[model samples]
Target: MSTRHVLLGLLASGPSHGYDLKRRHDEQFPEARPLAYGQVYTTLQRLVRDGLAEVDGTGSDGGPERTAYRATEEGTRELSRWAGEITPPAPFVTNEIFAKVVVSILSGGDPAAYLRAQRAAHMGRMRELTAVKSAAGAGLATVLSADYALNHLDADLRWMTTTEDRLTTLTAEVDAA
Candidate 1:
């Protein structure tokens, strides 16, 4: 996810302090890890430097003065363009787990055991995500996010099972090579 675009979108509502922006981001995107204060301030500084945002003013609510930021017209346009673009699905390429399994086979290790362990781990994570989804209430964002992750994990588990079945053939092929 583009933090730059997210910050701009938040600013579109109105000018906001960096702290408020972080708070709003956490509230809206609860599934995502919360942004650190340093990250928020640093990104804001970059936005100001790039002219995508301007430091409107500084004010304080009984604390240290906070710089308020407003998105520039260019920033709003950029955010609109980003919002309109369709994010492509991630390519089905070899990942670390696949690489590890192949290497294990080549090294005469137990690839089947690895797959079993991975499948168990995936199942555990799926259960955790299911619990989170069940407790998410009617929040569409949180529910959808959980669904996306659960679907991917389900696909991974299926792949692991298929790979486990073919481990013997894979080991033979690797030995021949």
Candidate 2:
């Protein structure tokens, strides 16, 4: 995830402190891993330094002072440009599952067994995500996030099935190489 751009997008909504930004990010991107407080602060500082954001204000209500940030004009322009660009559809497959499968074949390990285990794990996750998506009163964001994850998992499961079928050929090819 482009943390910098995400932070800028949050700032574009309005001024917000690090804590608020982190909370909003978590709420907005339910499928994404929660952002760390330190990461938010560090990204904010970098955005300010790069002229993408500015310190809007600092205030305290009988608590520690909170510095609020707002996206600068340049930041707005950058955000617009980024939002308009199309994200590349995973141009490369560098996933760990594929790596481990190849390594297993090379090392004379049971790639078939590994693939079976991995497939089981993926199926388990898909079930969990399905429940999440089917839950009553699940917000649109949560459902959408679950859908996104489910689709990716589905694709992975299909690939694993195909790879398992071709394992003999793959093993021979790996041995030759």
Candidate 3:
């Protein structure tokens, strides 16, 4: 994920201090990893340096003064362009499981056993995600993110099953080369 872009987008909402930006980011993107305070400040500094953001003002609300940031006109344009752009679908398969299976075959190890263990691990994660998605009061963002992950896990499980069924052929092919 583009941290700078995300921060700019947040600033587009309004001028906000680093603490407020970090809080809003977590609340807005519950599925994403939480941003660290240092990361938020660092990204904010870079955005200011790049002319995408500027310091709006500094004020104290009963404590230490904090600088608030706002997106510049250029930042707004950039954010709009990024939001409209399409994310390209993965063009190549980088299946670590497949690589491991081939490696196990080449090394005289039990590929079937490895697949079984991997499948079990995937199932466990799916169950956890399912529970999160099904929980009452789950927001749309949370549910959607969980669904996205579940779909990928399902695809991987299907591939693992198919590969296990074809282990004999795969083993022979690997042995030949």
Look at candidate 3 and tell me the lDDT of residue 49: 93
Candidate order (lDDT) = 3, 2, 1
Q: Backbone collision count in every prediction?
A: 0, 0, 0
lDDT of 2 by residue, 34-103 (tens): 9999999899999999999999999997889999999999999999999999999989989999999999
What TM value does model 2 have? 0.61
C-alpha lDDT (0 to 100) for residue 16 of candidate 2: 94
Question: lDDT values of the candidates?
Answer: 0.91, 0.93, 0.94
> Which lDDT tens digits does candidate 1 get at residues 1-177?
999899999999999999999999999898799999999999999998998999899999899998899999988988999999999877576698999998898888888998899899999999988888899364887788889999999999988988988877888889999
What TM-score would candidate 1 get against the native? 0.67
Give the Å error, residue 108, model 2.
Answer: 3.9
Candidate 3, run of 10 with poorest lDDT: 86-95
TM-score of each: 0.67, 0.61, 0.68
Error of 1 at 12 (Å): 0.9
RMSD of 2: 4.7
Question: Runs in model 3 with CA error above 4 Å?
Answer: 88-96, 110-153, 165-177
Which segments of candidate 1 are over 4 A away from where they belong?
58-65, 91-96, 113-153, 172-177
| Model number with the top TM-score | 3
